[model samples]
Target: MDTPGPRRLAGRVWIVPGDPDPENIRGSVAVVADDSGSVVVDAGQSPAHAREIQSAIRAAGLPPARWLVYTHHHWDHVWGACAWPDVEIVGHVSGQEILRREAARPWSHRYLRDEVRANPRLGPSFRARALAMQGWDDFTILPPGRTFTDELTLPTGVRLRHVGGAHAPDSTVALVPDSKVALLGDCFYPPPAHLRAPDDGPDLAMVRDLLSDDYEWYVDSHGEPTTLEQARRLVST
Candidate 1:
Protein backbone atom coordinates (compact mmCIF):
# COMPACT_ATOMS: atom_id res chain seq x y z
CA MET A 1 0.00 0.00 0.00
CA ASP A 2 1.24 3.52 -0.81
CA THR A 3 1.76 5.31 2.48
CA PRO A 4 -0.86 7.99 2.92
CA GLY A 5 0.22 11.64 3.19
CA PRO A 6 -0.48 13.91 6.14
CA ARG A 7 -4.06 15.04 6.53
CA ARG A 8 -5.05 18.35 8.07
CA LEU A 9 -6.94 17.98 11.32
CA ALA A 10 -7.51 21.58 12.39
CA GLY A 11 -6.08 25.11 12.04
CA ARG A 12 -2.36 24.41 11.64
CA VAL A 13 -2.31 20.76 12.71
CA TRP A 14 -1.81 17.73 10.50
CA ILE A 15 -1.36 14.03 11.19
CA VAL A 16 0.53 11.37 9.31
CA PRO A 17 -1.59 8.42 10.39
CA GLY A 18 0.11 5.46 12.04
CA ASP A 19 0.32 2.17 10.18
CA PRO A 20 -1.28 -0.77 12.00
CA ASP A 21 0.91 -3.30 10.23
CA PRO A 22 2.20 -5.83 12.74
CA GLU A 23 5.62 -5.90 11.14
CA ASN A 24 5.79 -2.12 11.20
CA ILE A 25 3.87 -0.74 14.14
CA ARG A 26 4.47 2.99 13.70
CA GLY A 27 2.65 5.60 15.74
CA SER A 28 1.05 8.67 14.18
CA VAL A 29 3.25 11.72 13.55
CA ALA A 30 1.64 15.12 14.14
CA VAL A 31 2.79 18.51 12.92
CA VAL A 32 1.80 21.86 14.40
CA ALA A 33 3.21 24.75 12.45
CA ASP A 34 3.29 28.53 12.68
CA ASP A 35 5.69 31.31 11.55
CA SER A 36 8.27 30.11 14.10
CA GLY A 37 8.45 26.68 12.41
CA SER A 38 6.89 23.26 12.99
CA VAL A 39 6.81 21.15 16.14
CA VAL A 40 6.58 17.45 15.34
CA VAL A 41 5.02 15.08 17.78
CA ASP A 42 6.53 11.61 17.67
CA ALA A 43 9.62 10.83 15.60
CA GLY A 44 8.13 7.66 13.98
CA GLN A 45 9.52 4.08 13.66
CA SER A 46 12.48 4.42 11.34
CA PRO A 47 14.48 6.75 9.11
CA ALA A 48 12.21 5.84 6.21
CA HIS A 49 9.13 6.79 8.23
CA ALA A 50 10.67 10.08 9.38
CA ARG A 51 11.67 10.93 5.81
CA GLU A 52 8.11 10.28 4.71
CA ILE A 53 6.87 12.81 7.28
CA GLN A 54 9.54 15.32 6.23
CA SER A 55 8.44 14.94 2.61
CA ALA A 56 4.89 15.69 3.65
CA ILE A 57 6.02 18.78 5.55
CA ARG A 58 7.78 20.14 2.46
CA ALA A 59 4.88 19.31 0.14
CA ALA A 60 2.49 21.11 2.48
CA GLY A 61 4.71 24.24 2.54
CA LEU A 62 5.20 24.00 6.29
CA PRO A 63 8.55 25.07 7.74
CA PRO A 64 11.09 22.38 8.57
CA ALA A 65 10.55 20.81 11.97
CA ARG A 66 12.25 22.86 14.66
CA TRP A 67 11.45 20.51 17.50
CA LEU A 68 10.62 16.81 17.76
CA VAL A 69 8.46 16.21 20.82
CA TYR A 70 7.91 12.69 21.97
CA THR A 71 4.62 11.41 23.35
CA HIS A 72 6.42 8.53 25.05
CA HIS A 73 9.63 6.52 24.97
CA HIS A 74 8.37 3.51 23.07
CA TRP A 75 10.67 2.34 20.25
CA ASP A 76 8.04 2.89 17.59
CA HIS A 77 7.56 6.47 18.71
CA VAL A 78 11.13 7.59 19.34
CA TRP A 79 13.48 5.37 17.38
CA GLY A 80 13.47 7.64 14.37
CA ALA A 81 15.22 10.40 16.34
CA CYS A 82 18.36 10.02 14.27
CA ALA A 83 16.46 11.35 11.30
CA TRP A 84 16.09 14.73 13.00
CA PRO A 85 19.65 15.36 14.12
CA ASP A 86 19.24 19.10 13.95
CA VAL A 87 15.81 19.31 15.57
CA GLU A 88 15.59 19.65 19.33
CA ILE A 89 14.18 16.51 21.02
CA VAL A 90 11.91 16.78 24.04
CA GLY A 91 10.34 14.12 26.26
CA HIS A 92 9.18 13.36 29.80
CA VAL A 93 11.96 13.29 32.40
CA SER A 94 11.09 9.71 33.32
CA GLY A 95 11.99 8.60 29.80
CA GLN A 96 15.63 9.46 30.26
CA GLU A 97 16.56 6.16 31.90
CA ILE A 98 14.65 4.06 29.38
CA LEU A 99 16.06 5.88 26.38
CA ARG A 100 19.53 5.68 27.80
CA ARG A 101 19.20 1.92 28.11
CA GLU A 102 17.84 1.60 24.60
CA ALA A 103 20.53 3.82 23.12
CA ALA A 104 23.18 1.61 24.68
CA ARG A 105 21.84 -1.56 23.16
CA PRO A 106 22.77 -2.86 19.74
CA TRP A 107 20.06 -2.34 17.11
CA SER A 108 20.83 -5.01 14.56
CA HIS A 109 18.14 -7.55 13.67
CA ARG A 110 20.27 -10.32 15.19
CA TYR A 111 20.42 -8.53 18.55
CA LEU A 112 16.73 -7.69 18.39
CA ARG A 113 15.90 -11.29 17.55
CA ASP A 114 17.74 -12.52 20.59
CA GLU A 115 16.10 -9.80 22.66
CA VAL A 116 12.64 -10.97 21.61
CA ARG A 117 13.58 -14.58 22.33
CA ALA A 118 14.65 -13.75 25.87
CA ASN A 119 12.12 -11.10 26.66
CA PRO A 120 8.61 -12.44 27.07
CA ARG A 121 7.23 -8.94 27.51
CA LEU A 122 8.12 -8.40 23.88
CA GLY A 123 5.50 -11.10 22.97
CA PRO A 124 5.97 -14.63 21.65
CA SER A 125 5.39 -13.87 17.99
CA PHE A 126 7.38 -10.64 17.86
CA ARG A 127 10.60 -12.36 16.90
CA ALA A 128 9.15 -13.45 13.59
CA ARG A 129 7.70 -10.05 12.79
CA ALA A 130 10.86 -8.20 13.83
CA LEU A 131 12.91 -10.33 11.49
CA ALA A 132 10.39 -9.85 8.71
CA MET A 133 10.66 -6.06 8.73
CA GLN A 134 12.32 -4.40 5.73
CA GLY A 135 15.80 -3.99 7.17
CA TRP A 136 17.46 -3.04 10.42
CA ASP A 137 20.57 -2.21 8.41
CA ASP A 138 20.26 1.55 8.95
CA PHE A 139 18.72 2.84 12.16
CA THR A 140 19.62 4.68 15.35
CA ILE A 141 17.89 5.51 18.64
CA LEU A 142 18.72 8.86 20.27
CA PRO A 143 17.49 9.87 23.69
CA PRO A 144 15.68 13.16 24.02
CA GLY A 145 18.04 15.99 24.84
CA ARG A 146 15.46 17.99 26.76
CA THR A 147 13.10 16.68 29.44
CA PHE A 148 10.12 18.12 31.28
CA THR A 149 8.45 16.99 34.48
CA ASP A 150 4.83 18.08 34.21
CA GLU A 151 3.98 20.42 31.37
CA LEU A 152 5.72 22.48 28.71
CA THR A 153 4.74 24.99 26.10
CA LEU A 154 6.81 25.67 23.03
CA PRO A 155 7.31 29.25 21.95
CA THR A 156 5.24 28.39 18.89
CA GLY A 157 2.11 27.64 20.97
CA VAL A 158 2.19 23.84 21.24
CA ARG A 159 1.51 22.59 24.76
CA LEU A 160 2.55 19.20 26.15
CA ARG A 161 1.56 17.55 29.38
CA HIS A 162 2.68 14.28 30.86
CA VAL A 163 -0.51 12.34 31.41
CA GLY A 164 0.73 8.94 32.52
CA GLY A 165 -1.75 6.10 31.98
CA ALA A 166 -2.04 2.30 31.93
CA HIS A 167 -0.81 2.19 28.34
CA ALA A 168 2.53 3.71 29.31
CA PRO A 169 3.42 5.72 32.38
CA ASP A 170 5.27 8.35 30.41
CA SER A 171 2.55 8.86 27.83
CA THR A 172 1.76 12.49 26.99
CA VAL A 173 -0.91 14.48 25.19
CA ALA A 174 -0.18 17.45 22.97
CA LEU A 175 -2.64 20.32 22.74
CA VAL A 176 -2.79 22.82 19.91
CA PRO A 177 -5.24 25.21 21.55
CA ASP A 178 -5.35 27.50 18.55
CA SER A 179 -6.37 24.55 16.45
CA LYS A 180 -8.73 23.18 19.12
CA VAL A 181 -7.22 19.73 18.73
CA ALA A 182 -5.65 17.30 21.18
CA LEU A 183 -3.04 14.85 19.97
CA LEU A 184 -3.50 12.07 22.49
CA GLY A 185 -0.62 9.82 21.62
CA ASP A 186 -1.60 6.38 22.90
CA CYS A 187 -2.46 7.90 26.24
CA PHE A 188 -6.15 6.94 26.07
CA TYR A 189 -5.65 3.39 24.84
CA PRO A 190 -5.40 0.17 26.78
CA PRO A 191 -2.04 -1.55 27.24
CA PRO A 192 -0.48 -3.04 24.14
CA ALA A 193 -1.30 -6.66 23.29
CA HIS A 194 1.91 -7.93 24.85
CA LEU A 195 1.35 -6.06 28.10
CA ARG A 196 -2.43 -6.23 28.41
CA ALA A 197 -4.24 -8.15 31.08
CA PRO A 198 -8.00 -8.75 31.08
CA ASP A 199 -8.87 -5.53 32.94
CA ASP A 200 -6.45 -3.12 31.31
CA GLY A 201 -7.55 0.29 29.98
CA PRO A 202 -6.36 3.85 30.37
CA ASP A 203 -6.94 5.53 33.72
CA LEU A 204 -10.44 6.96 33.55
CA ALA A 205 -9.56 10.10 35.47
CA MET A 206 -6.53 10.81 33.36
CA VAL A 207 -8.39 10.27 30.11
CA ARG A 208 -11.33 12.34 31.32
CA ASP A 209 -9.03 15.20 32.27
CA LEU A 210 -7.95 15.42 28.64
CA LEU A 211 -11.57 16.19 27.79
CA SER A 212 -11.44 19.29 29.97
CA ASP A 213 -9.38 21.02 27.30
CA ASP A 214 -11.36 23.16 24.86
CA TYR A 215 -10.52 20.85 21.99
CA GLU A 216 -12.96 20.17 19.19
CA TRP A 217 -11.09 17.11 17.95
CA TYR A 218 -9.07 14.33 19.63
CA VAL A 219 -6.49 12.44 17.60
CA ASP A 220 -5.32 9.18 19.13
CA SER A 221 -2.01 7.94 17.78
CA HIS A 222 -3.48 4.69 16.57
CA GLY A 223 -7.07 5.70 15.78
CA GLU A 224 -9.09 8.11 13.66
CA PRO A 225 -9.83 11.71 14.61
CA THR A 226 -12.86 11.97 16.91
CA THR A 227 -15.13 14.71 18.09
CA LEU A 228 -14.87 15.92 21.67
CA GLU A 229 -18.24 14.31 22.47
CA GLN A 230 -17.14 11.04 20.88
CA ALA A 231 -13.89 11.08 22.84
CA ARG A 232 -15.79 11.80 26.03
CA ARG A 233 -18.01 8.80 25.47
CA LEU A 234 -15.01 6.60 24.85
CA VAL A 235 -13.39 7.28 28.22
CA SER A 236 -16.72 7.36 30.05
CA THR A 237 -17.40 3.80 29.09
Candidate 2:
Protein backbone atom coordinates (compact mmCIF):
# COMPACT_ATOMS: atom_id res chain seq x y z
CA MET A 1 0.00 0.00 0.00
CA ASP A 2 1.10 3.60 -0.51
CA THR A 3 2.61 5.33 2.52
CA PRO A 4 -0.09 6.65 4.89
CA GLY A 5 -0.64 10.32 4.02
CA PRO A 6 -0.46 13.33 6.35
CA ARG A 7 -3.16 13.71 9.01
CA ARG A 8 -6.28 15.87 8.92
CA LEU A 9 -6.42 19.17 10.79
CA ALA A 10 -10.11 19.93 11.26
CA GLY A 11 -13.32 19.02 9.47
CA ARG A 12 -12.66 19.12 5.75
CA VAL A 13 -9.10 20.36 6.20
CA TRP A 14 -6.30 17.88 5.47
CA ILE A 15 -2.55 18.43 5.58
CA VAL A 16 -0.62 16.33 3.06
CA PRO A 17 3.15 15.99 3.28
CA GLY A 18 5.48 16.40 0.36
CA ASP A 19 9.03 15.04 0.03
CA PRO A 20 9.82 15.19 3.76
CA ASP A 21 13.56 14.52 3.75
CA PRO A 22 15.96 17.18 5.00
CA GLU A 23 16.91 18.27 1.48
CA ASN A 24 13.31 18.37 0.32
CA ILE A 25 12.35 20.80 3.14
CA ARG A 26 9.12 19.61 4.79
CA GLY A 27 6.37 21.07 2.58
CA SER A 28 2.70 20.46 3.32
CA VAL A 29 -0.41 21.13 1.22
CA ALA A 30 -3.80 21.89 2.71
CA VAL A 31 -7.22 20.89 1.36
CA VAL A 32 -10.48 22.57 2.30
CA ALA A 33 -14.05 21.60 1.38
CA ASP A 34 -17.40 23.32 1.72
CA ASP A 35 -20.77 23.54 -0.04
CA SER A 36 -19.05 25.44 -2.86
CA GLY A 37 -16.80 22.43 -3.47
CA SER A 38 -13.09 21.86 -2.72
CA VAL A 39 -10.05 24.08 -2.99
CA VAL A 40 -6.38 23.11 -2.70
CA VAL A 41 -3.96 25.44 -0.93
CA ASP A 42 -0.54 25.27 -2.59
CA ALA A 43 0.13 22.27 -4.80
CA GLY A 44 3.06 20.02 -3.76
CA GLN A 45 6.12 18.95 -5.79
CA SER A 46 5.23 16.09 -8.12
CA PRO A 47 2.31 16.21 -10.57
CA ALA A 48 1.50 12.59 -9.81
CA HIS A 49 1.45 13.38 -6.09
CA ALA A 50 -0.87 16.31 -6.73
CA ARG A 51 -3.24 13.94 -8.53
CA GLU A 52 -3.04 11.84 -5.40
CA ILE A 53 -4.12 14.94 -3.49
CA GLN A 54 -7.14 15.14 -5.80
CA SER A 55 -7.79 11.48 -5.09
CA ALA A 56 -7.58 12.10 -1.36
CA ILE A 57 -10.18 14.87 -1.68
CA ARG A 58 -12.52 12.56 -3.53
CA ALA A 59 -12.05 9.94 -0.82
CA ALA A 60 -12.86 12.58 1.79
CA GLY A 61 -16.26 13.12 0.08
CA LEU A 62 -15.37 16.37 -1.65
CA PRO A 63 -15.50 17.09 -5.35
CA PRO A 64 -12.36 17.31 -7.48
CA ALA A 65 -10.64 20.61 -6.71
CA ARG A 66 -12.50 23.58 -8.17
CA TRP A 67 -9.68 26.00 -7.45
CA LEU A 68 -5.93 26.21 -6.68
CA VAL A 69 -4.40 29.05 -4.65
CA TYR A 70 -0.63 29.29 -4.92
CA THR A 71 0.96 30.77 -1.80
CA HIS A 72 3.98 31.97 -3.69
CA HIS A 73 6.06 31.33 -6.82
CA HIS A 74 8.22 28.53 -5.41
CA TRP A 75 8.75 25.58 -7.75
CA ASP A 76 7.77 23.04 -5.10
CA HIS A 77 4.50 24.92 -4.56
CA VAL A 78 3.48 25.31 -8.23
CA TRP A 79 5.03 22.24 -9.87
CA GLY A 80 1.97 20.09 -9.32
CA ALA A 81 -0.64 22.76 -10.03
CA CYS A 82 -1.13 21.54 -13.58
CA ALA A 83 -2.62 18.35 -12.17
CA TRP A 84 -5.82 20.29 -11.61
CA PRO A 85 -6.76 21.26 -15.10
CA ASP A 86 -9.44 23.85 -15.96
CA VAL A 87 -9.55 25.17 -12.40
CA GLU A 88 -9.22 28.90 -11.80
CA ILE A 89 -5.62 29.18 -10.57
CA VAL A 90 -4.94 32.13 -8.26
CA GLY A 91 -1.79 33.81 -6.86
CA HIS A 92 -0.34 37.17 -5.91
CA VAL A 93 0.38 39.53 -8.84
CA SER A 94 4.10 39.61 -8.02
CA GLY A 95 4.19 35.81 -7.75
CA GLN A 96 3.07 35.59 -11.36
CA GLU A 97 5.90 37.86 -12.40
CA ILE A 98 8.41 35.74 -10.49
CA LEU A 99 7.18 32.60 -12.23
CA ARG A 100 7.66 34.26 -15.59
CA ARG A 101 11.18 35.29 -14.69
CA GLU A 102 12.06 31.76 -13.54
CA ALA A 103 10.67 30.30 -16.74
CA ALA A 104 12.82 32.65 -18.81
CA ARG A 105 16.00 31.85 -16.88
CA PRO A 106 17.93 28.61 -17.32
CA TRP A 107 16.73 25.94 -14.92
CA SER A 108 20.12 24.76 -13.69
CA HIS A 109 20.81 28.03 -11.93
CA ARG A 110 17.38 29.05 -10.66
CA TYR A 111 17.86 29.83 -6.96
CA LEU A 112 20.16 32.49 -5.53
CA ARG A 113 23.58 31.23 -4.39
CA ASP A 114 22.85 31.97 -0.74
CA GLU A 115 19.72 29.81 -0.76
CA VAL A 116 21.51 26.82 -2.26
CA ARG A 117 24.54 27.12 0.00
CA ALA A 118 23.72 27.16 3.68
CA ASN A 119 26.06 27.76 6.63
CA PRO A 120 27.75 24.61 7.88
CA ARG A 121 26.67 25.58 11.37
CA LEU A 122 23.17 24.76 10.18
CA GLY A 123 24.68 21.20 9.81
CA PRO A 124 27.36 19.26 7.92
CA SER A 125 24.52 17.65 5.92
CA PHE A 126 23.15 21.07 5.06
CA ARG A 127 24.44 20.97 1.49
CA ALA A 128 22.59 17.77 0.65
CA ARG A 129 19.40 19.10 2.19
CA ALA A 130 19.72 22.34 0.29
CA LEU A 131 20.13 20.50 -3.01
CA ALA A 132 17.16 18.28 -2.32
CA MET A 133 14.99 21.23 -1.34
CA GLN A 134 15.97 23.08 -4.48
CA GLY A 135 14.06 20.67 -6.68
CA TRP A 136 13.23 23.32 -9.27
CA ASP A 137 15.15 22.17 -12.33
CA ASP A 138 12.17 20.31 -13.73
CA PHE A 139 9.55 22.81 -12.56
CA THR A 140 7.26 24.29 -15.18
CA ILE A 141 5.85 27.73 -14.48
CA LEU A 142 2.07 28.11 -14.80
CA PRO A 143 0.94 31.73 -14.61
CA PRO A 144 -2.04 32.23 -12.36
CA GLY A 145 -5.30 32.58 -14.25
CA ARG A 146 -6.35 35.08 -11.57
CA THR A 147 -4.01 37.44 -9.72
CA PHE A 148 -4.64 39.90 -6.88
CA THR A 149 -2.95 42.20 -4.39
CA ASP A 150 -4.20 43.39 -0.98
CA GLU A 151 -7.12 41.00 -0.36
CA LEU A 152 -9.72 39.02 -2.28
CA THR A 153 -12.51 36.89 -0.92
CA LEU A 154 -13.57 33.83 -2.87
CA PRO A 155 -17.18 33.08 -3.61
CA THR A 156 -16.77 30.06 -1.37
CA GLY A 157 -16.38 32.48 1.57
CA VAL A 158 -12.68 31.75 1.96
CA ARG A 159 -10.62 34.92 2.01
CA LEU A 160 -7.23 35.35 0.30
CA ARG A 161 -5.30 38.13 2.02
CA HIS A 162 -1.81 39.28 1.21
CA VAL A 163 0.25 39.09 4.42
CA GLY A 164 2.92 41.44 3.21
CA GLY A 165 5.78 38.96 2.60
CA ALA A 166 7.59 36.30 4.58
CA HIS A 167 8.81 33.20 2.81
CA ALA A 168 8.82 34.55 -0.70
CA PRO A 169 8.14 37.70 -2.65
CA ASP A 170 4.38 38.35 -3.02
CA SER A 171 3.48 35.59 -0.61
CA THR A 172 -0.14 35.51 0.62
CA VAL A 173 -2.02 33.55 3.26
CA ALA A 174 -5.52 32.12 2.98
CA LEU A 175 -8.03 32.46 5.77
CA VAL A 176 -11.15 30.36 6.21
CA PRO A 177 -13.42 32.32 8.51
CA ASP A 178 -16.03 29.62 8.99
CA SER A 179 -13.40 27.05 9.87
CA LYS A 180 -11.44 29.54 11.95
CA VAL A 181 -8.35 28.27 10.17
CA ALA A 182 -5.60 30.03 8.27
CA LEU A 183 -3.40 28.56 5.56
CA LEU A 184 -0.15 30.23 6.59
CA GLY A 185 1.81 29.20 3.51
CA ASP A 186 5.40 29.50 4.74
CA CYS A 187 5.11 32.48 7.03
CA PHE A 188 5.24 30.75 10.42
CA TYR A 189 7.01 27.57 11.40
CA PRO A 190 7.00 26.11 14.90
CA PRO A 191 9.45 26.88 17.79
CA PRO A 192 13.25 26.70 18.14
CA ALA A 193 13.13 29.06 15.17
CA HIS A 194 9.74 30.71 15.03
CA LEU A 195 10.67 33.27 12.40
CA ARG A 196 13.39 33.42 9.80
CA ALA A 197 14.17 36.31 7.48
CA PRO A 198 11.95 35.72 4.47
CA ASP A 199 13.34 35.61 0.98
CA ASP A 200 11.54 38.92 0.42
CA GLY A 201 10.10 40.18 3.72
CA PRO A 202 11.75 41.11 7.00
CA ASP A 203 10.31 38.65 9.49
CA LEU A 204 7.21 36.74 10.64
CA ALA A 205 5.22 39.70 12.00
CA MET A 206 2.93 39.90 8.96
CA VAL A 207 2.02 36.26 9.49
CA ARG A 208 1.55 36.95 13.19
CA ASP A 209 -0.95 39.76 12.53
CA LEU A 210 -3.04 37.51 10.30
CA LEU A 211 -3.10 34.86 12.99
CA SER A 212 -4.08 37.35 15.70
CA ASP A 213 -6.97 36.13 17.89
CA ASP A 214 -9.14 35.86 14.79
CA TYR A 215 -7.87 32.40 13.83
CA GLU A 216 -7.98 29.47 16.24
CA TRP A 217 -5.86 27.04 14.23
CA TYR A 218 -3.21 27.46 11.56
CA VAL A 219 -2.03 25.11 8.81
CA ASP A 220 1.46 25.90 7.64
CA SER A 221 3.12 24.83 4.39
CA HIS A 222 5.37 22.92 6.80
CA GLY A 223 5.04 21.63 10.40
CA GLU A 224 1.94 20.55 12.37
CA PRO A 225 -1.17 22.59 13.19
CA THR A 226 -0.30 25.71 15.23
CA THR A 227 -2.24 28.09 17.48
CA LEU A 228 -2.42 31.83 18.15
CA GLU A 229 -0.46 31.39 21.37
CA GLN A 230 2.32 29.56 19.55
CA ALA A 231 2.42 32.28 16.93
CA ARG A 232 2.54 34.94 19.64
CA ARG A 233 5.55 33.32 21.27
CA LEU A 234 7.13 33.03 17.85
CA VAL A 235 6.70 36.70 17.16
CA SER A 236 7.82 37.81 20.60
CA THR A 237 11.04 35.84 20.42
Reference-based lDDT, each prediction: 0.80, 0.68
Candidate 2 Cα errors over 4 Å, as ranges:
1-3, 105-139, 188-202
RMSD of each: 2.2, 5.3
Q: lDDT of candidate 1?
A: 0.80
For candidate 1, write residues 68-184 as lDDT tens digits: 999988877886778775799999988878889987786666776687778877753355336334666566577778889999998998999998877778888889999999988
Using TM-score, give the best candidate's number. Answer: 1
Question: Clashing pairs in model 1?
Answer: none
Q: Residue 201 of candidate 2: its Cα lDDT?
A: 41
Model 1 lDDT at residue 154 = 88
